[model samples]
Target: MGLFSFLKKKSDPADAELVVLDTRLRAGEPSRLDSEAERERQRAIARATAAKIDEIELAMASDIFDDEPAWGSAARHPAAAAPAAPQAVPAEELPDAAALPASAPAVEESAILYANGQAAAAESLLRDSLQDFGRHERLPWWMLFDLYQATGQEAAFESIAIDYASHFETSPPAWQPLLPGPGTPQSAGVAATESLCPVLDESIAPRLARLLASNAPLVRIELGAVRSADAAGCAQLLQALQTLRKEGRELVLAGADTLMTTLRPMLAVGDRASGEAPWLLLLELLLLSNREKDFEESAMDYCVTFEVSPPSFEAPKRVSTAAPATGSGDRFLLPALATGDCAALLDAIDAYAAGRDLLVLDCSRLARMDYACATALQGRLRVHTEQGRRVELRELNHLAAALLRLLGYGQETGKLRDSLRLYPHRY
Candidate 1:
C-alpha cells in the first residue's frame, strides 16, 4: 500500500481490543477499586497501551480519583455526568490551580516549597489556599504560620495570628519565644515589692486571691524560675489576669520567656473544663509581653471571630436600670449569689453603697454560692478596701459562710475580716 494509504488503514483486531480495554478503564467502574484482583485486572488492561499505561496508573492513584464516590457501576455514577465546573462558583472567585481545594496535592506542593526554604512562596501559596478553601480549613493556616516564623516576619506572623483568632473565635496556636530576663529592653527591672515567687499550679489561686485582696493596681508575676506549668495552671493565670482586667487593673509578667515556653504547648493542647478559652490567656500573655503588634492583632482576631455581626454589647432593651434600694440601713440584699448572678450582687452593693462609708451584704436571701461567686465578691470588696471603704458580709447561711470562708472572706484575718459574719443562730 502507498504510505498515505497505510497511515489511514483501519486498526488490527489486537489494537481494537486494546482500545476497548482503555475505554473500560477510563469508565472508572466502582468495582475496579473494590478488590485487589479487580484492580490488578484493570492494571493488566492498562498495560495494553504501553505508551499511555503510566498515565493511566498515575490517574488511578490520584487523590482526586480516590475521593470520587464509588457506589455503583461507572455508567450509572452521578459524577460520570456531572459538570466540570460548579454552577454556583463565581468565575472570578475560582481559585488558581496552586490554590487547590481541600486536597492532598496542595499540601504536597506547599510542603515542597517549605522544604526548599521558599518561605515567601510557600506563604503566598498557603494564603491562597486559605482564601480559596475558606477559614475552616486549618492546614493552610498552620502551614502559613511556620512560613511566617521561618522568615522572621514577626509583624506579619502576629497579623496572621490575629486573623486566625478572629477567624476561629479562638486564639491561634502559641509560638512564644523565650524572654530575656531583667536586662532585656522589654523588661522593667523586678521591683523588690512587686516581684512574686515562681508561679506553680497549686499557688495560682491563692496568689491571685492575694493580689486581688491587696488591690494592687499592677501585679507583677515572676515566671523566670518556673520550669513548667500545666493547663490548669495556665487557666488559673488567665483567670487571674481576667479578674484584674475586669477590675481595670494590670498584670506584669517578669522572666516570662521560660514560663511561656512551658505554658505555650500546654495551653495549646486545649482546655474546655476551665469554662474559658485558652486563647484568652494567650492574648493576655501576648499583651503583657509587650508584643503590641501581636496583641493588637490577637485582640482584633478575638473580637471579630467571636463577636462578628453583632451590635455593641449592652443590657437587654427590656432591662431597666436597677431600682434604687429603698432602705436607710446600708445593707445590700442580694437576691441571688450563684456564679451567674454574682456580678448583679456586686452592682447592687455598688448602687446602695453610693454615699455610705460602710456596706453590709445581706446573704439571708442569697439562694446560692459557689467558688466563682465568692472569688468575684471578694475581688470587688477588695477594691472598696483599697479605697478605705468598709464592706461587710452579714446574714450568711452555713453554705454561704462556708463558701466565703473557703474563699478567705472574713473581717479579721480573711480579706473581708470581722466584716464577714454568719447569720444569727445559724453558725
Candidate 2:
C-alpha cells in the first residue's frame, strides 16, 4: 500500500496532535506583528517546516519494509542528495553485522520496549542489531542514538552518532521533543510531581506544556529525583520557565541545585569552542528567580575566567594622554572582551554607575563580543533607561553600533539615551 494509504489504515493517536498543530497554524490568521508578530511568525515557519517534514515522514512510512532494507538505496544515492559530508570511520568502528548473538531482539520489538519506558532494554536491542546486522537498517541506529540522548549519555550519543554517520554517509535523525500526553489538570498553585529518568530530550517540553496547561499561578517542578540532564533538558527547562514568565506565573524549580550542578560540567563541554561562558539556562533561571546579584556575580566570574570569548567588534583603547576618554564625571571604562567577558563586563558597568544620574561608558578599547554580549548590553541599556539615567556609550565600534541598531536602539532619537551613537562612521 502507498504511505498515505497505510497511515489511513493504521491510525496512531500520537500523530494526531502534530497534524492538529500544523492545521491550526496553517489556517489561523496571522497575529498583530508589533506585539504578537514574532510568535505568529514562528508558528508560520513551524507549519511550513512541518509540511516538509510530513513529506519525508510519509516517504519513510511508505517504504518502511521494502523488498530490501531501505538503507541500501540511500547509501547508493548521489553525494549531492545528502545534507552533510559523511565522516570516514576505521574498519573496526562498528561490530560486524553477521556476528550477532542469536537472542538479539528484533527492531519491531525494540520499539515496543521504548514505548514501555524500558530504555535500557531498548538500547540493548538496538546495539545488538548494530552488532548483528550493522547498517543494513538505518532506523535501528537512529533509535539507539535517541536512547543515548534520552539517557543523558552525551559521550555515547556522540560516539554512536559519529560512527552511524560514517557508516551510512548521512546525518542522523534529529531528536524530537516529547509529545503531549493525556494529563489530568490540577487547581491553581498546585505543585506537580513528575517522575523523571536521566534523559531530558524533546519530551520534556510536551510534558511541561501539559502541566502548565492548568494555568496555575505557581508551578513548582519537583526535580528531587532527577540526577542529570542533557542540552535538550536544559533548553526545555528554560523554555518552560520563559513560558511561565510570559503568563505572569512562576515556575519554581524545587530541588534543582543538585541536577543543575551535575548539568554544569556538561554545558561547559558544549561551550568550550564557542567561549560564550555561563550556560544561558542557568543565567535565565537566576534572573527569573530574582537572584540578580548571584547571576551578575556568576556571569562576571565565568567571563573573566574563560580564555577565549566569541568573536565581536572591538574599539581601540585610547590612552588618557589628553583627557580621560570618559567625561570628567563618574564614568566607567569598558574592558577588552576575552572569552566569557559579557557577564562581568555588564557587572562592571553596573558597579561604575550604581547611584549616579549620569553614567558614561568609555568603549575606547572594547574588543571581541558575540550575540550574548550584545543581548546583555542591550539589557543593561534598558535598565538604565528604566532608572531615568543619562548614559553615553562613547567611541563604540562599527560592529557594536550595528548590533545596537539591530536590537532596536535608535540613533535619530536623542531622548532615549539608552543607546548613544558616537563617531558616525567608525571602522
Candidate 3:
C-alpha cells in the first residue's frame, strides 16, 4: 500500500506496467478536431444525421406515414399489434433508404462535415449527394432551397427556383396546389405592391370587376372601361382601395399589370384605400411569403391569362369612318358607334376624314362617349372645321344630346374643342 496503492499493483513488472496504462487518467482528452482524418470522420457523422432528418421531412411531405397502415402500439385501437400480413410494393419500386446501397461515399462524408458546422466544406459533398440521388423525383428540393437561401447564394436560389417551379408548376393537381389552370398568365415579380397596373384597360379594369365579385374582407377590383382604366377609373379604384386599408386586409388585383405600377403611390389614392390593394393568391404572398426574393430575369410562369406590354394602352389617334353616303344632306342617318374608348373612337374619326377630302360624318345615334372619346372628337374638329367640311352630329339620342350639351357644345356654334385641354372637365 505504498506508491503502488493508486495503481493496481501487479506481481510481475510487465503486468504492473499494463495495469497502470489501462487505468483511467484524470486529464480530459485533447480535441481530435485538429487531425484531418478525425475531422473528416466527424463530418461524416453530421452528414448522416442531416440526411436522416431530410428523410423524415420527405416522409411527412409525401404523406407516406399516414398513407401507410399503422403498425404496432402506434395504432389507435388498444390491442393493436403490427401491420397485417402482405405489403403491396409500388409499381415504381419506392426507394428504400434503409436498403439503398451507399452510392456516394464523399456525399455521406460531406453531409457529416455540414452537420459538424463545416458547411462550406460540406457544400460540395451535398452537391455530390444530390447528383447521386437527383434521378429520383423526390430529390429533397425544399432542403436544397433552405440551404441556398440561408447561405444567400444567388446562383443556388435561381437553380432551385427553376427546379421548384418545374416540379410545382407541371405536376398534377394532387402534387402541387398552386399551379394555375390552363390559359392563365404565368408571372414572377419582385415587389408585391408595385404590380397593380397594366395598359389597354386590361389590368385594373378586369381585376376590379372581379373584385366586385369576391367575398374577401378586402376590396377586389375589376377594370370595366378601357378609356377610364388609366385616369378616372384608375383614380376611382385607387380611392376605393384607400378606404379598404383600414379594414386590416389588403387590396388584391388579379391580371397582367406589374405590382408596383398597379398598387403603389403612383396613383395617389390618399389614406387607406390607396394604402394597399386587396389580396389574390400571389398577392397574398405579401403576407404569406416572409423572405425577400429577387428574380434573375422576368419569369414566364405565374397565375394569369396574358402577359401584355405596358405600351399598347395608349389609344390610337386616328378614327375610321364608313364610305361617303350619297345622302350627306340627311343628318338623321348617322351611324351608331359603340366604343368605351374615347381616344380610339376619335382616332378612327380622324383617320377616316384625313384620308377622304370631302365627307360628312353622323353622330345622331351616338349613344354615349367617355372622356378620351370627347377629347378625340375635339381634336378632329379643330383640324377639320378650319378646312371646310367639318364633322356634324345629327340624330342626338337622349344620352348623346345630354353629353354634348353638358360638354358645352351646341349643335353648330360651339365646336367640339378638346374639353380636357382648355378646361378642367369633371365627370
Clash totals in order: 10, 12, 56
CA-lDDT, candidates in order? 0.47, 0.48, 0.34
What digit string (tens of lDDT, one per residue) describes model 3 on residues 1-427?
A: 2223354334744444334434523244344245678657656765675565555554454364332212111112223223334547421122111211335344345434433345466566556555556434222333343335334565765765666446433221111111122222221111012223435233455544444444443222322112223344445454444344433333323222233334333322123332222212223222221112311011111212123221111111111111111121212122234334445445545655654444333432232344445545655665676565544443232233333443444233444332111110000
TM per prediction: 0.25, 0.26, 0.21
Which structure is stronger by lDDT: 1 or 2?
A: 2
For model 1, the run of ten residues with the poorest summed lDDT: 316-325
In terms of lDDT, which candidate is stronger, 2 or 3? 2
Local error of candidate 3 at 333, Å?
77
lDDT of 1 by residue, 325-418 (tens): 1122324445432444456657756666677677655443343455565678788887777666776554343234434544455444544444
- By TM-score, who's the top model here? 2
Each model's RMSD to truth, in Å? 27.2, 29.2, 30.4
Q: Highest lDDT, which number?
A: 2
